[model samples]
Target: DQQVKQNSPSLSVQEGRISILNCDYTNSMFDYFLWYKKYPAEGPTFLISISSIKDKNEDGRFTVFLNKSAKHLSLHIVPSQPGDSAVYFCAARDIPGGGNKLTFGTGTQLKVEL
Candidate 1:
């Protein structure tokens, strides 16, 4: 069973606009959430993240929000650029389990258009 899921397989946004990617998790054990961006032929790179203690976290043009009640999270990228086009993955860490055990979503392709 996939603990995390990204309902949308792909998303397209105009350059300079906001791109929102969503994710959901079934495991209540997860406490830390992270967003990773991956380009073609490369591993995913850490983008942004949010902790269960906080509802939202922002960094520059990127922000991540977590709703514990809904077991949902989202990543928002403002003023999206062509360079931001890639597959975005949402990952959840099992705080109690420890040892860096994480569950990942399938991913959502984000395409930024000019």
Candidate 2:
């Protein structure tokens, strides 16, 4: 397989709470991990990324943790807001020669309720 998978198609969370999204992968050769957020009719925007050498990466209100041993990863958003409602994609790519290419998941639609 090309690798990378986000099993959830949607998620719902109340505003001001934490939203946790899960992802998994099969290929062991993937070295670069990225999470992207998208709005309807728009392209995904880079959120956070991690290398095979690290297990965690954080940016502002978002945090991503990777588990190399389990071949899994997750995204966490604190104080989830209504504005956070959108599609989230968990993506992966191999840094065969050092580049920002990627393979994306089906995506998950997160609805933040007020």
Alpha carbon lDDT of each predicted model? 0.93, 0.89
Off by over 4 Å in 1: none
Residue 70 in model 2: shift from native, Å?
Answer: 0.5
Q: Give the local distance difference test score of model 2.
A: 0.89
Q: Which stretch of 10 consecutive residues in model 1 shows the poorest summed lDDT?
A: 95-104
Clashes of each: 0, 0
The per-residue C-alpha lDDT of model 2 at residue 22 equals 90
Which candidate wins on TM-score?
Answer: 1
lDDT of 2 by residue, 54-109 (tens): 99998999999999999999999998999999999999887674366787888899
RMSD per candidate (Å) reads 0.9, 1.7
Q: Each model's TM-score? A: 0.96, 0.92
Model 1 TM-score on a 0 to 1 scale:
0.96
Q: Best candidate, lDDT-wise?
A: 1
